[model samples]
Target: MSISKNLPMLSILAFLGLWQGLAFYLHSPLLPSPETVARIFWQHCQSGELPYHLGMTLLRLIVSFAISMLLGCSIGIALGRNEKLNAFFDNWLVIFLNVPALVTIILCYVWFGLTESAAILAVILNKVPNVIVTLREGTRALDKDLLNMAKCYGFSHTKTLRHVILPQLHPFLMSATRSGLALIWKIILMVELLGRSNGMGYQLHLFFQWFDIASILAYTVAFVGVIQIFEFAVLKPLDNLALKWR
Candidate 1:
C-alpha cells in the first residue's frame, strides 16, 4: 500500500488501541472508549439525527464561505489593481486579521441579537480578510511584462484578462480558496456553537451539557469526515485544474 493509505490506517489502529488501553486502565465513564464512540455514532446515523445536524452545519458553512469569497475576491482584485486602495485597506485588514474570531462572533451576537444572520456575518467577517490578503498578494505579484505585451499587441481588455491576467491569477486564487474554505468552515462552526440553536456546534454544546463525551466525539468525527470529502472532491480537483497549466 502507498504511504498515504498506510499512514491513516496505522494512525487509526494506534488511536483505537490507545483508547482501549486508557479506558481499561482508567476505568472511567468520563472518557468513553473509541468503540463506544463508534457505537454512538452508528446509533445516531441509523436514526438520521446525525445527518440533520450535520447537514444544517454544512449549509451554514457553504453560505458563509460563498459570501466571504464574493466580497473578498472583489475587494482583493480592486485593491490589488490600485495602490491607493491597497494602502487604505491595509490597516483595516490588519485589524481584522489580528482580531480573535471568538471575540468577533461574540460582538456580532451582542450587536445583532443572537440570530443566524449574526452567526453568518461573524463567520464572513472573520474569513474575508484572509482571502483578501491572499488574493491581494497574488495581485501584487502579477507579471508586468505580460500586461505590457498585451498592451503592445493592442489586445482588448477582455482578451487580456482571459489570456494574461486570469491564467496568472489562477494559482493565487486557488490557494486563497483552499485556505479560506478550511478556515471559514471551522470559524462558522464556532460561531454556531457560540450563538446559534441548530448545527453541529449546538449539538456539541448539548452533548457537553450532559457530559456525553462519546456523542461529542461522534459529532466531531462526522464533521471531520465531511471536511475530508470537501478537500478531496472540491479543493483537490480545483488545485489540479489551477496547476494544470504550470
Candidate 2:
C-alpha cells in the first residue's frame, strides 16, 4: 500500500503505543491505556448505551445546525445586498457575535427552562452569528462583473441565485459548515451537561464523577471518530463536487 494510505494507520498505532507507554510509566488511574479504553468502548457499544446517547447528541446537533445555517444564510445575504439594512443590523450582529456562548446557554435555560427547545435555541443563537459573519463577507466579496453578466442574460431571480450567487458563496459556505460542525457539537455537549438527562455530554459528566478515565477516553474517541468520518465521507465529497464547477 502507498505511504499516504498507511500513514494514518501508522500514526494511530504510534499514538496508542505512546499512550500505553505513558500509562505504564505513570501507573495511574488518571491515564488509562488505549487497550483499556478500547475494551470499555466495545463493552458500551454492546450494551447500546453509547449509541443511544450518541444519537441524542447527534439529533440536537443536526436540528440546531440546520436552523442556524438557514437563518444565517438568509439574513447574511439580505444584509450583504442592502447597505441600509446591514448598517441597521450590524450592531446586533456584533452583539451576538461577542456574547459568550456559555452565557447564552445559561440565559436560554433560565428564560426558557431546561427543555430541548432551550438547548437547541442556545446552540442556534451561539452559531448563527458566526455563520452570518462568514457568509456576509462572502456575499460582499461576490464578483459584480459576473452578477452584471447574469443580469444582462436576463436570468430570473431563482436562476441567478442558483447559478450565480450560490457557486460564488461555496467557499464561505464550506467554511461556515466546517466551523459550525466543530463549534455546534461543543455547545451541544455543554448544553447537555448543564441541563439534559441524556447525551454523550451527560455520559461524559457521569464518567467524570466516577473518575472513569477509560470510559471518558472511549466515548471521546468514538465521537471524534464519527466527526472525522463525516468530514471525510460527506463534507469532503460535497466540497469536491461543488468545486468541479470551477
Candidate 3:
C-alpha cells in the first residue's frame, strides 16, 4: 500500500532520471535535456500560447468525451439487456471494433465537411464500440439473485436500475471511464492535428514542421502533467466513491 501510494512520484522521478541519462549519453539536439524542455515549457506558459492551446484541447476533449460516454452507455445498456438488440448489433459492433480510427476520422471529415462536429463525431464513432462491449459483459455478469429480488419486490425499472443494477455495474463503469479518457484524449489530439487548427495537436504539428524538438517535448510534458493531475485529483476520487463497496 505504501508503495502504491508513492508509486506515481517514484515512477515519474525514475523516468526523469532515465530521460536525463539518455540525453547525456546521446548528446543530440533532437534529444534535448529535461532542463531545456522545462525552460521551453516555462517560456510557453509565460507567453500564454500554451494555456490557450491547452484550454481549447480541454474543451474539445470534454465535448467529445461526454457525447461518447452518453451514447455509448445508452447503446451498451440496450444491447446488453436485450437479446434481440444485441444480436442485431453484434456484427456492426465487430466491424466498428475492427475499423481503423483514421478511416473513421477521414470519413467523418469527408462526409461532414471538416467542422468541429465532424471531429467530435469521429472520436465518438471510434469509441462507442469499446464501451458497448465492456458494458454488455458487465450486464451479462450482473447478479441474477439481486435482479430477481428487485423483480419480486415490484421495483420499477428506474428504481431497480438505480438500486440493483447500477451498483453491480460500478466496476465496469469505472473501467470504461478510465479507458475512455485515455483513448478519447489521444483521438482528440489526432482529430485536431489532422483537421482542426487549434489545440495541442495543432501546436505539435506546427512545431513538427519547424523541427522544434524542445518545444514539442515541452508541450507534451505540460499536457501530460494536466492529464495526470486530472487522473489523480478527479478520476481517482470518483473511482473510489463509485467502487468503495467492492
| lDDT, residue 87, candidate 2 | 99
lDDT by residue (tens digit), candidate 2, 1-246: 698889999998898899999999999989988888999999999999999999999999999999999999999988888899999999999999999999999999999999999999999999999999999999999999999999999999899989999999999999999999999999999999999999998999999999998999999998999999999999999999999867
Residue-level lDDT tens digits of model 1 in 21-73: 99888878788888888999999999999999999989988899898988988
Q: Report model 1's TM-score to 2 decimal places.
A: 0.89
Cα lDDT over the full model 1: 0.87
The lowest-lDDT stretch of 10 consecutive residues in candidate 2 is 237-246
The pairs that clash in candidate 2 are: none
Comparison by TM-score, 1 against 2, better one: 2
Ordered by lDDT, highest first, the candidates read: 2, 3, 1
**Candidate 3 wrong stretches, greater than 4 Å:** 1-7
For each candidate in turn, the TM-score is 0.89, 0.95, 0.95
lDDT of each structure? 0.87, 0.95, 0.91
- Tens-place lDDT per residue, model 3, 113-183, is 88999998999999999888988999988899999999999999999989898888888888888899889
lDDT, model 2, position 22: 99
Lowest summed lDDT across 10 adjacent residues in model 3 is found at 237-246
Between candidates 2 and 3, name the one with more favorable lDDT: 2
